[model samples]
Target chain A: MRKGFRTVSGLTAALAVTAGVGVTTAFAATTTTSVDFQTHGFPTVAAQAAIPAGQGATIKAGDATVTIPTGTFSDPVEFELLEGPLSSFAANAPSGQTPVFDFAFKVVDQKTGAIVMKFQKPVMFSLTNTDVNANSMYYNIAPTGTYTLNPVKATISGDTLQHAIAGAPVGWVVTSPATSVAQTTSPITGLPFADWLFVGAALMIGGGVLIAVRRKVS
Target chain B: MRFAGRSRKQLLRSLLLVGGGALMIAGALEIGRIPLAYLRVARAEQTTVSKPLVKVQIVAPPPAKVVSYSVNALYPPAAAPGHQPVTGSLMGRLEIPKLGISAPVTQGTALSILAVSVGHLSSSVLPGEVGTTVLAAHDVTYFHHIDELAPGDTLTVRTSQGVFTYKVVSHQVISVGTNVPNTPYPSLVLETCYPLDALQLVNQRYVVRAVLVASHLTPSSAANQ
Candidate 1:
């Protein structure tokens, strides 16, 4: 009886140790950040200033709001402010074959701290005009290199005008606030915690069986 | 006493069970590790701009440098009523009948644009123009069967201005430093990374060259004629 009790206790202790290790390792490997934008359209310069690396930011303007999760930017970035009708600017005016509003901005590099690259490429934004009187505006920029934007977490509140990036689709609606888009990632890539836990459980069961068989034979 | 007195068969079974468990764990780890590596490589490739296989200076051909050829004579440069300068917009649709490929042609080679449709190099001339209209796309997706194209294959491009058809002149697989031949007449160049089956970063490109054969303005534009 004593021997059996000792073996059971030993196996329990071993199982506990493995379970604790697996849980700790899993948590250490995963990191996440969520940002909520309470406003619609572009974020104000003052609001942009408060955004930190790997932190979420919510842009709320009127009834429209956009939520951007942390890790979207590899480094700190400043948003170029634009007000009034977007088409008023000759440069921002729609031209060429596609008559979509095109905007340009520079991503200020946090390191060496210079504006290393200019995002002159037009990022297509879909506008949902719920209010006919509301002025329409869009701020589009693709920040490459150190100021890389995570397209996965980047989303908007409007009808999707076009699908851009791998996961994030560009949405369009004149409405103030809507669930424009969302991004999903593979949980396995973060950490195979479930697999590790399974392995630990298997080991405990296998060890228990071996001990029981050995004791019975003796 | 647990193993010393045991039969050989029992001992062997115990050893096999332990070995099998270890192998299972190792296999699981390997399976989980490989996908992570592939994801890393794919992400890196998309983010970094890979050097072009051909080293031709990207120059926007002057508007006045028109090429006079028998083919151009057939499709006179009438005023394409709605023709506008290419500005990274959807210029047209590219179709290779033999390959049964039809994809939208956009104005820029930005990754965001290329992710959805073929990108027309902004520096290159537009279709029906007097220079090369360069187009690029991903190998594994839209242009996977590009290798199947041969001399004499037909490529048709439809734009807001007009519809242009071309005949394949030749194909080349060149390294990043090689220069694509410059022809005096309007041509079409389709480019993608070489080794269609490769999953790693490719250093060479498969380029298909085709010369203009026919062209016609869109019906609305033709009405102005």
Candidate 2:
């Protein structure tokens, strides 16, 4: 009975340490920022055709009440896009694919079930563009009530996707208020594909060694 | 292999060690799906202001007839019509039946997702409408696919409004600022990097001018008849 008790205690301690380390590593990666209108490039409507009445959007998250802003523009035909939270937008992003985060969407008004606008090209958003490599979501709400989102975490290296997609100096600079955060059901944890690999390797080696030593003693 | 003459205590240790290790490794692998964003462009996207030029002809449909609402509430805060949200994006998917180039299109040019990629312009390019509806697309992403396009390529724009079909009457690459002179026919103008991926002074701007062919404007048709 003592031996069984000893083994169970030892295993419990080991498991706690391992899981704690994983959580700590994850906390170090997720960064958050409080972005205002200026941080997001305020749009200017040079010219636009008049659009009649349209539905707007409202985002409800945590304690923050997020609403769309009326941007500055020169044209009376200006259109307004009220975006929801980045976390809520979805896209067609597949891992291990070149040029991740395809932003293609049809304009829909939940009330009408009507398709107002359709995008022929894919607006590509990359999570690996800044420091957080994982699936990240960004929302762009058009005045016509169309929501286009890039909804996947992908491996984006170098400026190929950035330059090719933006057609100009391109890439998103993420500003997180918290340098890092605890994992809150987010798809990605802190660290890269290599970090976990190292932990696994260590566990395997330690387990093997402990097993070997026990046999010898026996 | 070490199962020989083992005491119960020794056996317990072995099991805990081996079993715990396997579980942790598998869990670690499952956690490896996240991506990292470390690389940056270092420099911002380049935008060169062109010198003021001459007045040009306007062919696009008379600015769409929108019912004017004087109510202050009609225009909500953070609302900019035709304004595209700023995010890391390039090519938008395009399907112009007239243009054989039915694939992903980059956002700079007006034709495909230009407004979505660039500004608030999606509502402007109505297919089969009376006036010329201009659409610009990046020459590189979807346009590179156009390098493979010939004169006879048919272009199509499938929007929430409906599917618009056009035929490429003429295609040319001009300077970035060269706007067509004539009020011109109702058409779709697609722009992109002139020669494949030419980073040089936009070496040339490829313009595909397609006149309206047919449209699936059923809602209006149903409303009229």
Fnat of every candidate, listed in order: 0.00, 0.07
Q: Tell me the fnat of candidate 2.
A: 0.07
Per-residue alpha-carbon lDDT of candidate 2 for residues A1-218, written as tens digits (9 for 90 to 100): 11223332232223211112111001111111211221222222211233223422232221112222232111122122222212111122122211212122112323343322211222232222222233333322222223333222222343212211111011122211112111111111112234555665676666666656656654
- lDDT score, candidate 2: 0.32
Per-candidate TM-score against the hidden true structure: 0.36, 0.28
lDDT of 1 by residue, B1-225 (tens): 756666765775676567656655555664554354445435533443232211112233322223212212322443222333445565677889998777777667765566556777665566665446677776655677887888888998877657788888677886654544333245678877677654444667777878777777666544443
Docking class of 2: incorrect
Best by lDDT: 1
Worst 10 residues of 1 chain B by lDDT: B49-58
